[model samples]
Target: MKNNKIFLIGLLAMVFLTACNEDVLEYKPEGLLSQADVSTTENLEGLVIAAYAGIANDEMVGPITHQWVYGSVRADDAYKGGGGIGDVDVINRYEMYNLTIPDYGDWMTPKTWVNHYKAISRANFALELINEASEADFPKKTLRQAELRFLRAHSHFMLKLLFKKVPYIVETMTAEEKANATNDMTNDELWNMIADDFLFAYNNLPQSQDEVGRADRSAAAAYLAKLRLYQAYEQNDTHQVTSINPARLQEVIDYADDVTGALEPDFGNNFLDGFDNGSESIWAAQFSINDGTLVSRVSFVTGLNSPNSTELYGCCGFHLASQNMVNAFKTDTNGLPLLDTFNDVDIFDSVDGNGKAPLAPGITLDPRIDHTVGIPGRPFKYRNTVNEAGDMIYNFSWARDPGVYGYFGNMKEQQAPDCSCYVKEGPFVGTSKNVDFIRYADVLLWKAEALIQLNQVSQGIAIINRIRDRAANSTNRPINAGATDVYAIGTYPLTLSKEDALKALKFERRLEFAMEGARFFDLVRWGQAAQVLNGYVAVEKTKRDFLANAQFTAGRDEYYPIPQREIDVTGGLYTQNPGY
Candidate 1:
């Protein structure tokens, strides 16, 4: 009995020793990477790529790159045209200017917050690794570091625009430091942190990058100019532009001067797929299809914004350009945009009853309107003729909810059904066309805005005329030649006063970048959200009664509330935005 007990004990000890072996414990799965594997030079590049990929990590419900929901739908450019108001009701809250709670649109607001920070975190991780690497061992270390910093600043800038306050997570932060990150800083301090990252990038990066989507020094300078322009409009806690700093406006002018990129000869080319990364695109977030993955990296940020046609690219119709938006393109007798008297006349009432039938006349529009809006019966994406299936025309039936939203379809983000950029997953139609993060035109306008604010009125007016000239010459398209009477745009006079020039600059921005999702942010940056949006609703509600009693409180509605989940997780270390 003693011998048998001894044998059992010896067998159990052998099994335990084998199970606890170092080789067995340290075995990594064939497909998985170990910690030390990421320390190499090539893997460092992979980390940078990962950071780039995160910039456009958007979905139908949560858009990180495209701001149609937060900027367009929230502003006068469009409505949340889905199945109904019940579908993504959080977006309705945004559109209506209702007082927001932290959990409101959590899917969208928090998701976007997380998405931006995710990209920032990836950049931070790559930066840590790149900083440790020697330039001798990894020749592109400094360059990669600059790229990572540019990306980090891009996300932080966006977060600042959205939430007004966010913790600056840096690579140097220890785990404990990260845990205690707080959102308690002056607006200038936060802007300076983001500006510091951009300054480093501008100093170190090349004028152009070898890769199409990479950020170059020119892109950094352009972004810096944009940042400075926002910073120049110093705001108080009540979200009022207390003072416009002249020095910062000069910075806007200087940084914009350092930038380099030419505008596309045809303004319509900016939205076309083949023209991506062309002269006008300073920096773009790239998308791909048929590249070696299970599912190609396509743009699902606009997935829900497709037409409702079963024969065409079918899905829920969203981000429809407002009647007010369509009317804002109307030109006066001088062929210049009607500055103040635009919303007084509704285009639908003036045209064919509901804008569905053939036009009756008496409306002259900016030629760029053809590029910005998808009017029913107009040439869909410049296709004058219908296909054999009879579907090229943008029909009124394309609207998912016509009674609630208007009849216009968003044109800029969409692709023609036959184009290679089109990709549909389930009911959602996504595209692979790159979203131009920074365009030359945007930089031009930034410089113009800065100059005007600095009281350099004539110089700014000249720039305004330059943009208007592009719009006037946009009538060169043969597709729009038959409708030449409807398309007319004129340049602003250089002798105009600063006040009139400022108005022209503001109106020009709306006409130039209508559906690109920057209107609401523009309003907020100018500290005109309450006045402009409240005024918009007063007139627009008469047209679309969904906004029956809409209001935009200046301080509260300027930025979204910081996500409650973030605050809770941090043990209330993160404070909510004012008036949340």
Candidate 2:
């Protein structure tokens, strides 16, 4: 009996020893673990914060790259020519219909692509880890998942617009899978993926975020609405009109209405100081001036490039607002668009001594003009006025030859004089207040656009009028004339038919959202991009020698060629765009 008991004890000891050995084999070093370890509820939150931080990088949301690529690289805006205008010149040439093989030397295309994908990859990694976590962390799981999904969706959306046939990688695939991957999906497939992600975000995200600039339900819906509108356009290959889903369009209208009450009473508040949290902003790039990390590339590009600056514009030179763009704001007899009289007016009015008047028209002339352009009298939004002499000296080259190259810095958000000088610290010293991503006004306009396309013209008109009135009286609605100029305060009365109202809506969008990065895509989705851009370029070339080289042809120039290098890397597995 004693021998049998001892044998049982010995067997139990052997079992315990084997189990301990298995546990030791399973142990992994902290650094050697998969992304699943680093992307926990605690660790992954920092990654979400890092996603926003990445935008301030020079290649991503940084001001110079963002503004130059999105703002000036369109038909309506021109590059102010000077000795250092190489980057602007390249953009204008492309905007004016020049196409080339992707050398990858162009920092704009490759850098933007890399930045967007990095953000996407980070978000993708977060999603992968969050999904693998336990249900006890579900709430954090849901929120982080939604945020990462929103980021991934938006990054892909931008790529879809630019590259058109980008590989739709949802997960971090192996090198073998990536090599085998191809962009065989249709535009509809791409749009569907974008819509699905946004819908998930809209359904799960909070109406507002604890911190500003984070994704919310309204922003997701707004983006979804935009994607729907783009899909509604007619397509070439399928010969099928991407009809608007009434149900989907109504979803957009309902979501847009959800935030109307949250909008600021004043439209200009959406763009001015202390306006970061105003109701008008559905979502904007979060930047804290006090945090001392808010860097803006747009502020650098548009601010006064002066004596101490080595930027493209030493003074204020780049993104010269064209006379045509300004003229688009003129009101008709009934305080409506000068659609019929569009070509009748002289846009190049002479400037007075203070760089104000006739050339520098008052907001009273057209509130939009005042909002977008810096006339002689009003303060420029982003220029360094304190060091005027220095600014003049640095930007003298462009000022001397405005006609040859468009040289006029945008003044929407200027840096302080002391920080105006370019240094190892940065191109500008002040905090970057300019938006690098979405804005509330953009969301509102996007809703207005979708509504108009859905035959909800009157509703769309109300939205636009709200924006105009904001600029008129520093309020969102019309008021009794007092200190404000009533004539300058144009009434956006909806007297036209549904068809005509659509045109008016389009024009209003062009005027209000001008140079804010949506123009080219807006034109493309509306099916008028080819005609409008080409026609404008031709007419401008005839009118100005500087524009003589600027010409656009439809079809071939409508979409850019897939970077040749990407295609080569895929060994012809990836097909190029039709013309490219």
- Among these predictions, the greatest lDDT belongs to 1
lDDT of candidate 2 over 262-316, digit per residue (tens): 5556544555545554566664554443322233222333333222234432343
lDDT at residue 183 of model 2 (Cα atoms): 79
Q: Rate the local accuracy (lDDT) of all candidates.
A: 0.80, 0.55
Model 2 lDDT at residue 61: 25
Q: lDDT by residue for model 1 over 1-580, one digit each (tens)?
A: 1111110112211221222111211211121345466657767677777777768777877677878988899998988888877887888888888756778545678878777787687687678778888888899988889998999999999899998989998888877788788999999999999999999999999998766678889999999999999999999987789999999999999999998888788888998878877888887787776554556668889888888887888788888888889889888888888999988777643225444434447778788877887777676677767774356666777878888887788888888888877788888988778788788999999999999988899999998888888777775553342443476678888889999999999989998999888999999999888898888898888878788977888789999998898888789999888887
Weakest ten-residue segment in model 1 by summed lDDT: 1-10
Model 2: runs farther than 4 Å from truth? Answer: 1-40, 55-68, 78-88, 137-139, 172-175, 238-248, 289-316, 351-364, 382-400, 406-409, 413-430, 434-436, 475-487
